[model samples]
Target: MTRGLTPSVHAIWQAMGLVPPPGPLGARHDFTIEDTDLILRLAPDGQAATLEGTLGALTPDPHEATAQLRKLLRLGLGLAGFNRAALVLPDVNGADAAGAAALMALADRRPDQPPLRVTAQARIAPGDPRAAVAALEDILQWRSFARDVIPASAEPATAAAHPASPATPPDSGADFVIFQP
Candidate 1:
């Protein structure tokens, strides 16, 4: 099992007022996403959130595990009114880059709300889930910075420039792998 790299995720879930019922030590975080009941068991650098339904959907593609993690977290936060949230992905030698980009593209789908943000930052250890989770702080900062930098009523210039793009960059960092706009 990976280290408890997803403690931040757990905290985020708690912030949204959704938490799993108490259980034995390391109680799994119970929640639903995309109509899927997930039981999140913390690992060393990540959490193992197994799909808890029919055998047809028991496990996600191993290669897409990171993607699945991102999706579940984003969906929950979005429902909790953190729709404009940013995802800070670690540049793990391109390990999770594609997944992060996919998330960014997905983030722009909700034109009604602000675009999703994704940044590939440095100083955070690569191949460590904590790196990605740690970046959450920067993401929250970006949200606040975005509010002040961009006019609340107006969409970002990039979003305006491309009205049909699903990937929008609400904010970006120099080392970040920006997506959408």
Candidate 2:
């Protein structure tokens, strides 16, 4: 088993049967999984890494955007088996942004189009190369689900039409059930 050493993103890439980008192992790299573009940045200490990519954008309508934002937040909180990833919306200045202040800025600035860009990030632990690959795959899966499955507007009737599924298996002995839409 791999241990003690910092996880190598190149190793993870090769393990996933993809060619590593031409660069030093520690450098940030951009790659694609299932046609979804992703950026990988390793921590300075090499103890961890982050995989981030844009999933989509929030709806232009205020009410719809609010609802969409809430759902994205819930997904980031690990709701609906999407715990492997977190959603982020960077501000105009490109700083990590969230909550009301960011929302207000997004609203005030870009009224004609979807102002808030949604990104999904997943943390990769050190040591095991498989873990990093898994994290990348998980984020890609969740990205696809978010873009295809999640509705732009959360209508009561539309929400009720699709029931949620349990995140865990029934006989797993877990006490709680996480329902994903």
lDDT of each: 0.36, 0.62
Kindly list the per-residue Cα lDDT of model 1 for residues 35-91, writing each as its tens digit.
Answer: 222333443344432212100110122223334445544543553453323334334
48, model 2: CA deviation in Å?
1.3
Instruction: List model 2 lDDT by residue over 55-96, tens digit each.
Output: 766655556667777777766666446457777666545354
Clashes of each: 10, 0
Candidate 2's C-alpha runs over 4 A off are: 1-7, 44-46, 77-82, 91-102, 106-114, 149-181
True lDDT of residue 74, candidate 2: 68
Candidate 2, run of 10 with poorest lDDT: 152-161
Candidate 1 regions off by >4 Å? 20-137, 147-181
